[model samples]
Target: MKATQELHNLGQSLWLDNITRGLLTDGTLARYINELVVTGLTSNPTIFDQAIRTTAFYDDDIRKKTAAGKSTEDIFFELAIDDLTKAAELFRPDYDATGGVDGVVSLEVSPLLADDADGTIHAAEKLHAQANCPNLLIKIPGTAAGVPAIEETIFAGVPVNVTLLFSCEQYLAAAEAYLRGIERRINAGLDPHINSVASLFVSRWDHAIGDKVPAELRNRLGIAVAQRTYKAYCELYDSPRWSKLAAAGARPQRLLWASTGTKDPNAPDTLYVQALAAADTINTIPEKTLLAFADHGKVSSTLPADGGDAEKVLAAFRAAGIDDQALAAQLQLEGAESFNKSWHALMQCIVEKGQSKSTGTQAEQL
Candidate 1:
């Protein structure tokens, strides 16, 4: 069996961290679902930005919406929603089979609103309502501002994918926000089974610290952080606090590994994917990473439920003068800034394309 399937058999979900209109129209997304064991997908400002700029797949929709005088943001969401809705439909079977735990697709709100809690909450609600798919998750960052929005959005009963988390601390905070929302729902006599996942990013840690750490420690920080976070996740779910909520029908917020693609060329392409294969967790991979794993990846031991050796590995990093907590905060800030840049670039691309279309000149040259 392919290592992807092996990982799936070990009870981890392998999700694709990409989506494009061409992937959908050309049946590539569906093929991934069938052949690659990809049970879910995720999209953000950056992915959509690239998809829109490089393909004529959305040109007709852009032309129609431009003619209708819709703003660039409006056109962007319209195009995004259409694509995600279709992708959501393709995953509906896995969603139903897993009882809403495994099959899901995530769409993030404007990263530009990362600092605006109210605006993020509003966008999440709008996106979820428009999506109209039970398996669709409205992704919100786990920033200080986004935490409250996440809690309130969950209380309002929208499934959320908490994104851009960089540390166990950030993951725990996001998980707590999800729990608080569920707890409030139970207090208010509402269903406690609203689904959510806290996505802790993996590869970026190694990328950020690769040069800082010794050569022997290269490409190891991300997996160690993930192992530590997984340990926390298991402990949280087993605690009395969570047992009470579970008794009330609340689902434990699953931990998702984002940015799992390897950034270091010297490391195996499937380094993160192979190392972080823990049951009940999710690994969201880029398409190339997914294929690489399926081709030559090896799955050996599952991550220890008790977070074995994670602390020891972390201590080594600490001895090297690396403070994981402080770095997590910095990475989260940088991620938000990167997303904001991508969001702005996407909007500008659409505006320029709209202008060119209006002027009878194609956006292809510019």
Candidate 2:
């Protein structure tokens, strides 16, 4: 059996961390669904930027939307929504089978809203409504500003993929925000079964620390962080408060492992995928990593519910002079900034492409 299938059977969802028009138009996404156990997908500004800049698949639509005089941001979202909704349909079977637990595709609100809570909330609602797909999730960063937006968006009944979370502390904050939103729904006599996922980014931790720690410590910080966060996740799942909410028909806002792609060339390609295998959690992986894992990965023991030496590992890093809290803060800030940069570049690419199309048309007329 494919290791991907084994991982899926182990109960960790395998979501492709990519979506391109070519993938959809050529049935590649569907093939992954039918053959590779990829039940869901996630996208961001970087992915879209790469897709638009590198492929001609979106050229005609870009020209059409540009000709319509839509703003760059508007054109981008329209294209993103169109692609995501189609991918959502392709996964609809898994979505229905799992009762909305898996098989969802995520579309993020403007990364520029990373600091603007009100704007994030509004855009999240508008984007979710615009997509009009039940399985589509609006991603909001788990930054300090984004936490309140997450609460507000969730309470408004928009399913959210809370992104950019780093430490266990950050994960808890996002989880609490999700909890507050569900609690408000119950208070308002609304259905408490609103779905959400708190996405904790991995891999970037190791990349950031880079040779600062010893070789034994290299490529290990991210999984250690995830283990610590997973322990917290287990605790939250067993919490009496969450049980009460569950009884009220609220779904547990699942813990998702994002950025699972290995960043260190010396590290095993399947390092993140194989090590982070825990049931009931989601691991969104890059396409290359997914293919690598499916070909040669092996799933061993799953993450221990009690965290499996996570604290010990963290302490070792602390001894190595790594400040956990400070690094987490830095990573969160950098991640937001990275996305903001990608968003701007994506918009600029759209503007240039749109203008080039117009220029070519006028030249032909001449």
Candidate 3:
């Protein structure tokens, strides 16, 4: 079996992190689902920005929405919603088979709302309803401003994929928000089975500190941080509080490994993917990384439930004068800034394309 299937057999979900209109229209996404066992996917402004900038696939819809006098953001969301709802239909079978625990696709709200809790909440709720796909998750950042929004969004019955998490603390914060949301639902007589995933970013840690650390320490920080967070995740889902919630039909929020694409040229392409293989977790990898793993990757070993050498590895970094705590804060801030940049770029791309310039009827099937 391919390593992707093997990983899935070990109970890990592999989701493609790239989505383009071509992938959907060209049958490539379907091929990945059937052949590579990719159960779900997640998209961000960056991905959409590239997709819009690089292809004419969206020109027809852009022109129609633009002609209707919709704003750039409105056009973007309509296009995004249409794409995601179609993708959701494709994954409906896996969603049903797994009982909503897998086969989910995520779309993030505007990065402009990251600092506005109320805006984030409203966007999440609105996006969820607009898409109206049970397998679709509306992403909200895990920032302090986004935590409460996450809870309220969940209480509103929208599935969430928590983005921009860089540390165990961030993951725990998001998980707490999910728990509170579920608890509130139980208290209010709402269903407690809303699905959510706490996404912990992986490679940005190494990319940020790769040159600051020793050669041997390069490409290791991300995995160690993931191991530590996984320990917390295992413990949280197994705790008495969670057991009580589970009895009330609340699902444990799954831990997701985001940004698993390797950044160091010298490091193995599958470095983060192979290292972070744990059951009941999700690994969302870029398409390049996914194919590399399916070609030559190994399961290696499942992550240690007790965190194995996570603490020891972390202590080594501290001894090297790299404070993981401070850096976690820095990375989270930077991640938000990065998303903001991409969001604006995407809006600009839409503005330029949505102008009345004709593209010859936009071809068929786009």
Tens-digit lDDT track for model 2 on 209-283?
A: 999998889988999999999999999989999999999998989899999999888899999999999999999
Query: What is the C-alpha local distance difference test score of each model?
Result: 0.91, 0.93, 0.93
**lDDT tens string, model 1, 160-269?**
99999999889999999999999999999999999899999999999998788888788888889988999999999999999999999988899999999988889889
The 10-residue segment of model 2 with minimum total lDDT is: 357-366
Give the best candidate by TM-score: 3
Residue-pair clashes per candidate: 0, 0, 0
User: How accurate locally is residue 116 in candidate 2, as Cα lDDT from 0 to 100?
Assistant: 95
After superposition on all CA atoms, what RMSD does each candidate show versus the true structure? 2.1, 2.7, 1.4
**Model 2 ranges off by over 4 Å:** 358-366
The candidates, ranked best first by lDDT, are: 3, 2, 1
Tens-digit lDDT track of model 3 for 1-366: 999999999999999998888889989999999999999999999999999888888887897799899999999999988888888877888999999999989999999898999999999999988888899999999999999999999999999999999999999999999999999999999999999999999999999997898888888999999999999999998899999999998888999999999999989999999999999999999999999999999997999999999999999999999999999999999999999999999998898888858746455424
Q: If scored against the real structure, what TM-score would every candidate get?
A: 0.97, 0.97, 0.98
For candidate 1, what is the lDDT? Answer: 0.91
Weakest ten-residue segment in model 1 by summed lDDT: 357-366
* Candidate 3 overall lDDT versus native: 0.93
